[model samples]
Target: MMRWLITGGCGFMGSNFIRYWLKNHTEDYILNLDKLTYAGNPDNLKMIENHPHYRFVLGDITDPQAIESLVPEFDGIINFAAETHVDRSIAQPRDFILTDMVGTYNLLEAARFHQKKLIQISTDEVYGNCPSGQNTEQAPLLPGNPYSASKGGADLLCLAYHQTYKVDVMITRSCNCYGPYQYPEKLIPLFITNLLEGKKLPLYGDGSCIREWIYIQDYCSALDIVIQKGKTGEIYNISTGEGIPNLEVTRLILQEMGMSEDLIEMVDDRQGHDRRYSLDASQIRQLGWNPEYLFSMGLKETLQWYRHNENWWRKIKSGEYQQYYRQQYAQRHKKSTLER
Candidate 1:
């Protein structure tokens, strides 16, 4: 059985991947290493916490020494640890640099030294705004913000390592992912949870910015296929090939939640927000993987999940997150004069 080390396994995408991995690959062993940042919630994987084939370790990937000691024990590594929130990245760029870039450098080093396979989880924002067409893996990296820049830097590092040291590394850059267990800071979950809580949906800018949305389950399957069939030293883009504007998405969320459009509160746009991010996922589709859930179905599933699990997101919106929300949005809220 293969033993894999999953970094940032407590975070939204990572945690969902672990649950997906364990359920599908019962024979494989997994060791989850996470720093347990505010976004990394252990409760996301509580159902499989006691599984014999899976274990959790509290650690940070930024520490080279810790990574060195851990890399030798696993057959391969999947680096998912990252500072992902764009607003937070804008507010605190250093954190994104440390976690997304430096942390990736450390993981690449360990993977190189140990000669182990590494799959770097990435985002489509690295391609910057794709206003006209879908970006293939050959697109140039023109990241618009601190978070994307850091991720883009790490992608370059992975390619560099492969060219210079022959490291077994592959990268997967996907579009926006939404589903159960996602931290409510992102657009979809934020709107869903906000509507549920009787709070206003803070619509950024004119809400005309467009993005492709993919269900987490579909993304997990794509990643699984990539791990099994993808060639080393290559980059793969995963997308649904559908881009929806922010306002339209907000309307869909409101409709799904049975809320009115009046709930949308115009807020200050994010600094350096990309207008669009589209990926040509045709490459991975050749590996016999296709998204099963359409945006409408996926959004409905996500809304139902939050509706059923009110306690989960409610706890997250309180305390520290509340302070963060106010700090991040309070000033921006001032610029808004529209409530509908």
Candidate 2:
């Protein structure tokens, strides 16, 4: 029975992964380390808190002492810790650098010294705007904003460690993921929760920017395979290749919720927002993996999740997120019709 450490385990994707891992790998044990940041809600994994094979530790990856003490216990590490939100990153770039870059450095050092495998979770935003064909794993990183820049910096550090120190590390860069237990700060969850509460949906920059989406389960399954079979010092991209414009997704969400189009508020676009992002998942597919859920099936499941879990998201949106929301989107004025 292998024991693993999953950092940032209380956040949306990380929490979902813990549930997925423990359910499928009954013999394996997971120790979850989280700082309990704003997006890291303990409620996400409330059902599995008492699982015999799972344990939670309240800690930060930024602290070298904490990571050094823990890395030796686990056979390997899967790092999900980061300052993820783009809006928040724009307002506080230093935090993103500190966690996404420096925190990753600490984990790398610990893993290097302990001779353990490290799986770094990354994102497609590192490629910035992809106005044309799909980008392969070898595509150059041209991160536009502070959030993507920080992530890109971490990815580079992982590669450097693998090359210079012979650290057993692999990186996975995934497209946008949507599913249950996602904090409302993200696009899909924010729109879903807002529609549920009869609030206006903020559509940025006429909502034309395109992005690929993948179900959380599909990503978890892909990651599981990566952990078991991925090559050391290699990078993989996980995606559904299902690209759609933000406006279309907003309209689809409105249609699914039986809400009027009037609920869409055309707000000013984010600074340096990429026009599109798409990845060719040929490498992962060659590893005998493929996505199961289409956007329609995933969207239905996601909507149902938020529909029933009102109390979970309501508590988050009503707390510190409210103040940040006001600072981020509340100040954005509706774009003039002439600009459209």
For candidate 2, the 10 contiguous residues with the lowest summed lDDT are 331-340
Off by over 4 Å in 2: 320-340
Question: What's the lDDT of the predicted structure labeled candidate 1?
Answer: 0.89
Query: Could you give the C-alpha RMSD of every candidate to the true structure, in order shown?
Result: 8.5, 9.1
Tens digits of per-residue lDDT for model 2, 1-340: 7888999988889999999999899999888888767777767877986787887777789999988977887899999999899999988899899999999999999999999999999999999899999999999999999999999999999999999999999999999999999989899999999988889999899899999999999999999999888999999999999999999999999999988999999999998889999999999999989999999899999999999989889878888544564234223311211110
Instruction: Give one digit per residue, the lDDT tens place, for model 1 in 1-340.
Output: 7899999998889999999998899888888888777887767887987788887777788999878977888889999999999999889899999999999999999999999999999999999998897899999999999999999999999999999999999999999999999999899998888888789999999999999999999999999999999999989999998799999999988877777899989999999889988899999999999999999999989988998998888878886544564344334323322111
- Candidate lDDT (C-alpha), each: 0.89, 0.90
TM-score of each: 0.93, 0.94
Q: Which residue pairs collide in model 2, if any?
A: none
Residue 288, model 2, lDDT = 88
* Ten-residue stretch with the least lDDT total in model 1: 331-340
> For model 2, what is the alpha-carbon lDDT of residue 188?
97
